[model samples]
Target: MSTNLTSETAAPTRVALVTGGSGGIGRAVVERLARDGFALGVHYSGNKAKADETVAAIVAGGGRAIAIGGDVAEERDMSAAFDAVEAEFGGIDVVVNTAGIMILSPIATMDLDELDRMLRTNVRGTFVVSQQAARRVRSGGAIVNFSTSVTRTQFPSYGGYVASKAAVESMTLILARELRGKDVTVNAVAPGPTATPLFLTGKDDVAIAGLAQAVPLQRLGQPTDIAETVAFLAGSARWINGQVIFTNGGLA
Candidate 1:
């Protein structure tokens, strides 16, 4: 009898490892990818509870997910995290670098220490995770990084945060060029005035409303808004590589 190879036997499940998967936008990306039918690695920095919660929700929705935690800026931590996902999910097809920190201060008045802290997380963390992803992500996969729309807006008090993400944008573009012929796409998503815990932490109602009004769409971006762009980049958008997509609602 001839052996019949079904499509299931020929193709394995696609896998995604999302850094900061427990946070607002990160969780949305994780859930969106899970619904897109990829097995997920929900990575957290220190909050295992949130990580586990994300995983549980994915599971409840009949999706496959596992919690992985580590400092994204540490090469060793990220290496181990990648190892764990590979062991659990076979291979990673997409690596999403959504783990980052933001500290707002005017350049002249900002504390250097706070700037350093933001850089360590936003820049070093991205570099470390990208290093692992460059080495590990399977062919025909994608590596998505995060930048910020403030880079374009030139907003005050965002000097530190914008500097870090500027590095990310530069690095992302170079990496995409370097990955040429690898069949792996690399890009960064720049979101503006998103209503996340990170964005809403210090801003009062007036400041928030002003930001929303600045957008031509007249609303603060939801996590899902950013996640939709990510979902497109991660699963399809084969032609859209080496570019930063501004996910803001016409913030200029």
Candidate 2:
């Protein structure tokens, strides 16, 4: 579909570009933002099919959305993705960077390549996208980056992942400060063990149950839970800047 947008026409709505929007948590965010009346730019790295599905769903629901594809870690690709959204929707108002990867391995035995890949996607990707958002997002816009609860939990097999997320947390705080007089909010969401394909791929039922039980709520977090947090950040939660909101059911 054409997204029914163009640069020549003045934008009549707030626009949001959600990276990794074809995935579980990302999809939830997209749907929620659509409901909130933001024109959606659903971004995916390698899965056009999933991206199209997300866009179709939004369109079917009488919302505006278009699928955008690009490598989050590549500056040019990410730039193009942002440009496409702006070209279509007039300008970007909110950016939620949920594009990330997780490969669990202990510190000592972890593959260097895996660590690099994770850092590239989670760290560099956030940085690149954040850079663009900082430059392009309109005043009163919000930038929400994704982090993981493993950084606080200090899990053994999550050393590399935790390290990557720690960088995200740091960057989020610094970016918020850097945007001193911009009136834009920059924050990070640290989700704790949400029941997404990314988080559920390797664990057994028993292990999953154990994790769920460990949480104070005695249940795994749903994508919608995190999505609600994001929607809040992307909307009127202006004072909640430079903070990492953990949406993990009180799972510290």
Candidate 3:
């Protein structure tokens, strides 16, 4: 749970820093990257125990990983986390900004503090992490940012949250253009109504079932489904840059 890492440097592998690795989609991405033989930095904000659990899962599966605690919203913490990755794994090859916040409310009644937190964590945090990743990630490496399908659905009570993700989508496009000659790819994955804890909260079973049925796929998306898309973007998907790959199973 502490920042003190387990000092058993394994053989060299692709280095990845996955912000919010303790959560559902993030955990899936971490496991997939580990399976791809990457040395992962499991970044977490508060749930160090969950992050450590993620790391253990990878290590137990013959993969190497380390858990680091830091606030993704703070530039200092973002940079420090990247620095840790560089120090631990020589240099970062991939950065996935899956850290985000979803506080839903109508714009008329939304609290400014909640809005600020969403913007700070989901928008500013992504920019801070991606900006650093843009500069430090090795050429031929990739940067994957998380966006939501709500940006397409335009649902009620999700105004602020959708706005933040929209910013991520836009920023990712421009970032890909800016990282043109670096051989680094920038893209966003916009998942729709995934069956993560973040998506299940505050909803009854019936409501959740109805929500799942609304999707054309006829079921809520699993984290692995999204992780598979991320894996493709990370490896061997060269020339597929600057695009938002919507992994929503035809929902979007």
Candidate 4:
């Protein structure tokens, strides 16, 4: 399937539903997927305006997309969101679970509520979404889950967040095995200190500069950087399943 975002030629490449499509990384993934010829369902939790902006951008550019509001942690919301996608496009071919929360605090002082929420959305949410994708998406479909580099390099206040992402990584591997012979690839993408909102918070210019300097690339990662890897995993690379491909610019 192929479509001209700028009206060169418009053909439906495939259909994708990207959870958290309103956020920085998710937004880039949604745009890249649309450019790759996939009709999109841009899902958001509490950012309807941002999600609408994403849909409008895609449509205005000549690609096809729709804004969907739902909570990733809720099965009913996910079912409805998937139904919306099937209604617009033909069927689901790719599902990217990027809806995650990163409320950081020292383990010793971390609030239980924050931990619970992160696990529910990041870990459990991944399971439910992947299950649905496995059952409903076409045979050549794919499911990409998000992990974090904190699982590789320990950070001071990122214990809870890292733990949540670790669970995602674990489940993705098993899901790949369980889907044997289904022709659907399951994988996880782990990003490092990206320039997204989650990484830029509560930090001054100097701090961000220092953080960037820590990486060999001497800068934070752009969302498109990660999205490129996601596109690869979702495309014709069936041999690369059940792996955590880290796109950290050498930070890991």
Model 1 segments more than 4 A misplaced: 1-10
How many collisions per candidate?
A: 0, 0, 0, 3
Native-to-model Cα distance after best TM-score fit, residue 27 in candidate 3, in Å: 0.4
lDDT to native, each model: 0.94, 0.94, 0.91, 0.89
- Candidate 3: what lDDT? 0.91
Top model by TM-score, which number?
A: 1
C-alpha lDDT (0 to 100) for residue 200 of candidate 2: 95
TM-score of each: 0.96, 0.95, 0.94, 0.93
* Candidate 2, RMSD to the unseen true structure: 4.7
lDDT of each residue in 1-252, candidate 3, tens digit only:
566645565535788999999889999999999989999999999999999999998889888888988888788898889988889889998999899989989999999999999999999999999999998999889999999988888988999999999999999999999997999999999998899999888879998898798898799999999999999999889989999988887885
Model 2: worst 10 consecutive residues (lDDT sum): 3-12
- Candidate 2 residue lDDT tens string, 169-191: 99999999999999999999999
Candidate 3 segments whose C-alpha is farther than 4 A from its true place: 1-12
Q: Which consecutive 10 residues in model 4 have the weakest lDDT in total? A: 2-11
Give a tens-digit lDDT track for model 1, residues 28-84: 999999999999999999899999999999999999999998999899999999999
Cα error, residue 117 of model 1, in Å, equals 0.7
